[model samples]
Target: METVTTRTVEYPADGLTMVGHLALPAGTGRRPAVLIGPEGTGLNDFQRRRADALAELGYVALAFDLHGGRWFTDPQEMLERCLPLIADPERLRGIGHAALEVLRAQPRTDPGRIAAIGYGTGGAVVLELGRAAADLKAIGTVNALTTGRPGEAANIRCPVWAGVGSEDPIMSAAQRDAFTAELQDAGVDWRLTVYGGARHAFHHPPVDQSVVPGVAHHPRHARRAWHDVLALLAECLPVAAG
Candidate 1:
């Protein structure tokens, strides 16, 4: 396995001093990079490990922070913060752009060859970034089949892939239809994958027990989704083996 190095980085976002985790592959040359976004609860070990895994695959990865440096173990608190943030596209864009700037400024990142992937609320943030038309190779989201503002999705310049559980209440069939319609009307290349019998946050491991009602972990689907996301990245970014 390729050696990976990681560090905690502090940046500004959402009127708070956001703390993020940056992971780099072995070597000093520029490489394709990814900006990772976490679930509503904020950036935790799972997201950090994802970044590390991406780095091991020769991509410079950064798991961006959502709620400053603090993670919410309480479901209510997470919802309180995430609900408002998700409702405000400008706020989501602000948070995402801050993290994107951080990733682009990195010495190891090929700024023009970057992708954005997010889970849950973080997923919405990455989608907002795409709607804002950030220069990206690709965009991927899980558990966040959010619709963009009218005609705003037309700004997206790259392909987008979204994964969600069939049983997720938050991303129901109607929501998925709206999301797809927006992408379609924008003429953006986008695809959606619905994992059968999986619920919201199905990609997450069963760690924090205090989760919102409708959240469940499906280990098999989680692994499958990870593989699919990796495939998306490989197709769009194509980092060389270390």
Candidate 2:
């Protein structure tokens, strides 16, 4: 197995000191980089492990924070903060841009070859970044099917892949339709996968704390979504083989 190094990186985002988990693959040569955005609950071990896994695959990965080092165990509290943030495109773009800058600054990262993969609110942030015309090779989101402002998706310069549970009330069929319609109308290269019978946050593991309604873990679909993300990255921002 390749040796992966991990560290905590603190950066400013949304007026908070966002502490992100940065993972670097072995060797000194620059590699394709990926930004991992955490769910609305905030950055935690799950996302850190994902960054390490990506590093093991030879891509520099940074699991960026949303709650500035705090994890919300209360679903209502999480919604109180995240709902407004997700609704504001500019705020989401600011957070994504800050994390992207942090990732690009790393010596191991090939700035020109970078992708963003986000979960839930994090997914929404990366989508907003794409809408804002940030230079990204690919954008992948799970459980977040947010539509951008009028015609702003035309600014997206790369392919986008989205995964969501069919039973997810938050990202319902109608919402998915609107999101896809926006992307299609903008002529962006995009794809959406609906996992049958899964609920919102199916990609997330079960938490000890109380979770929002309609959120559940589907291990099978979670694994499938991860594989889909890997495939998308392989196709769009492949790291050079050693």
lDDT of 1 by residue, 36-154 (tens): 99999899998999999999999999999999898988888888999999999999999999999999999999988999999999999999999998999999999999887888999
Question: Clash number for every model?
Answer: 0, 0
Residue 161 displacement in candidate 2 (angstroms): 0.3
What is the C-alpha lDDT profile of model 2 across 54-88, one tens digit per residue? 99999999999998899988888899989999889
* Model 2: worst 10 consecutive residues (lDDT sum): 208-217
**CA lDDT of 151 in candidate 2?**
82
Q: Which candidate is the best by lDDT?
A: 2
TM-score, structure 2 vs. true: 0.97
**Candidate 2, pairs of clashing residues:** none
Q: Give candidate 2 regions above 4 Å deviation.
A: 209-211
Candidate 1: what lDDT? 0.93
